[model samples]
Target: MGLLAAFTHTLEITLPVFLMVFLGLGLKRLGWIDAHFITTASMLVFKVTMPALLFLSIIQADLGRALQPDLIGYFIGYTAISFFLAWAWAIWRHPRVERGIFTQGAFRANNGIVGLALAAGQYGDYGLSVGGVLAGAVIVIYNVFSVFILSLYSDEVDTDFRSLIKNLARNPLILSVVFAIPVALSGIELSGWVMTSGGYLAGMSLPLGLICIGGTLSVTAFKRSSTIALDASLWKLVWVPLFGVLGALAAGIQGPALGIIFLYLGCPGAAASFVMAKAFKSNDKLAANIIVITTFASMFTLSFGLFVLKWLDLV
Candidate 1:
C-alpha cells in the first residue's frame, strides 16, 4: 500500500478503538461511571472476559500454524532482554523504592487489551488468533518478571517464592492458554453452547477493557509525576516498539506474525502494572502515571508503526 493509503488504513482500525477510550473518559468525567465501576469492570475483563476471548481464539486457531516457535521465541527473548535492561537503567537512575515501578512501566505492554484490539481491528479474527497466542505467551513471561522484580524490591516480608508461583498459577490468562492449547492441538471441538457462550463473553472483552483503561487514567497523577511519567512513556511507547519491530523484521518475522509482534511491542504499559506495583509496595503513583501517559501516547505511535509496516508491505 502507498503511504497515504497505509495511513488511512491504520487510522480506520485505530480511531474507533481510541474513541471508545475517550468515551470512557468522558463518561467517567460526567459521573456516569465512577471508580467502583472502573475497578469492577477491570476485574471482570481481567478474570472472566479476557480469558474467554483467549480461549475462543486459541481453540479456533490452527495450532500448527498459529503456534510459531520463531514468533514466540522472539517475543520471549525480546521481553527478557528488555526487562533486564530496563531494570539496570532503573537501578542506575532511580531510588530503590521506585526502581521496580520504573522497570515494570518501561517493559510491560498492554498486550491483552490494546495490542489485541489493534491486531483484531487491523486483521480481524486471523490477526486476533495469532495475537491471542502471542498475548498468552508474553503475558506469562511478563507476570513472572513482574512478580520477581516487584518482590525483589519490595519492603514487605511477606513477598515470597510461593506467592509468585501461586500468582502465576492463578492468572486467568495463563490458565486459558494452558487449557486451550492442549485442546487446540488435540483438535477437540467445543460443544455448540459452550462456544456460543464463550463467543458472547469474548465479544465484550476488548471494549470493556479499553473503557476501564480510560476510566482509570488520572490526570492529577500525570501532573504530579510528569517527568517520570514522560520518561516511562517514551520508553514504552516509542523506544521499545521501534527497536523491537526492527529486530523482529530483521529476524525474518513477517505477515500477521510480524503485525502482531509490532502491535505487541507498541502497546502501552498495562494498567495491571499499577495494581502489581501497589500490591508489591512499589511506587504505584508512578506506575499509574506511566500507564496513563503510555496508553494515550501509544495511539499515535501504534498507528504510525502500523502505517509504516503496511507501507513496507510487512503485514
Candidate 2:
C-alpha cells in the first residue's frame, strides 16, 4: 500500500476499536452508565467473557503453527527489560510513593483488547491465532511484573509469595490459557453447540472491554496530569515501542511477528493500572492520568507507527 493507503488502512482498523471507548465515555457523561456499571461490566469482562474468548480462540487455533517460541521468548525478554528500565526511570525521576504506579503505567499495556484488535485487523486469521498464543504469555508476565513492582513500593499491598501464587492460580485469564493449551495440542474437537455458545461469549470480550476502558477514563484525571503521569505516558507510547520495534528489527523479526510485537508493545497504559494502584493504596490519580493521556495519544502514535512500517514494507 502507498503511504496514504497505509495510514488509511491503519485508521480503518484502529478507529472502530477506539470508537467504542469514546462511546463509553459519551454514555458515562450522559449518565446512561455510572461507576457501578463500569465496575460490574469490567468484572464480567475480566472474570467471564475474556476467559471465554481466550479459551475458545486458543482451542480452535493450530497451535503447532501459531506458537512461535522465538517470538514468545523475544516478547518476554522485551517486557522484562522494559519493566526494569521503567522502574529505574521512575526511581530516578518520581517520588518514592509514585514510582511503582508510574513504572507499571510506563510498560504495562492493554494488549488483550487493543493489540489483539489491531493484529486481527492487519493479519486476519493468522493474527488472531498468533496473537492469542502470545496473549497467554502476556497475561502471565504482565501481572507478575505488575504485582512485584507494586508490592515493592506499596506497604498496603501484600508481598506474600503464596498470595501471589494463589492469585495467579485463580486468575481466569491465566487458567483459561492453561486449560486451552492441552486441549488444543490434543486436537480435541468441541461440539457444535459448545463452539457456538463459546463464540457468542468470545465475541463480547473486546467491545465490552473497550467500552469499560472508555467508561473508566476520567476527564478530571486528564485535567490533573502531572509531570509524573505525563512522563510515564511518554514512556508507554513512545520509548517502549521505539526500543521494542528496534529490537525486533535488529533480531531479524519481520512480517506478522514484528507487527504483533509492535502493536502489543505500543498499546496504551492499561486501565487495570488504575484499579491496581487504588487497590494497593498507590497514587491512583496518577495512574488514571497516565491511562487517559496514553489512551488518547495512542490513536495517533499507533497509526503513525503502523503507517511507517507499512511504507517500509517491514510488516
Q: Model 1 reaches what TM-score against the true structure?
A: 0.95
* lDDT, each prediction: 0.86, 0.88
In candidate 1, where is summed lDDT lowest over 10 consecutive residues? 156-165
Count of clashing pairs, candidate 2: 0
- If scored against the real structure, what TM-score would every candidate get? 0.95, 0.96
| Residue 34 displacement in candidate 1 (angstroms) | 1.4
Candidate 2's residue-wise lDDT over 73-167, tens digit each?
Answer: 99989999999999999888889988899899999998878888788788877777788778767887888888888989997778777877898
lDDT of 1 at 230: 80
Off by over 4 Å in 2: none
Residue pairs whose backbone atoms clash in candidate 1: none
lDDT of 1 at 242: 82
Q: What is the model-wide C-alpha lDDT for candidate 2?
A: 0.88
Per-residue CA lDDT of candidate 1, range 267-305, in tens?
889888988988887778888889888877888888888
Give the number of the best model, judged by TM-score: 2
**Ten-residue region with minimum lDDT total, candidate 2:** 155-164
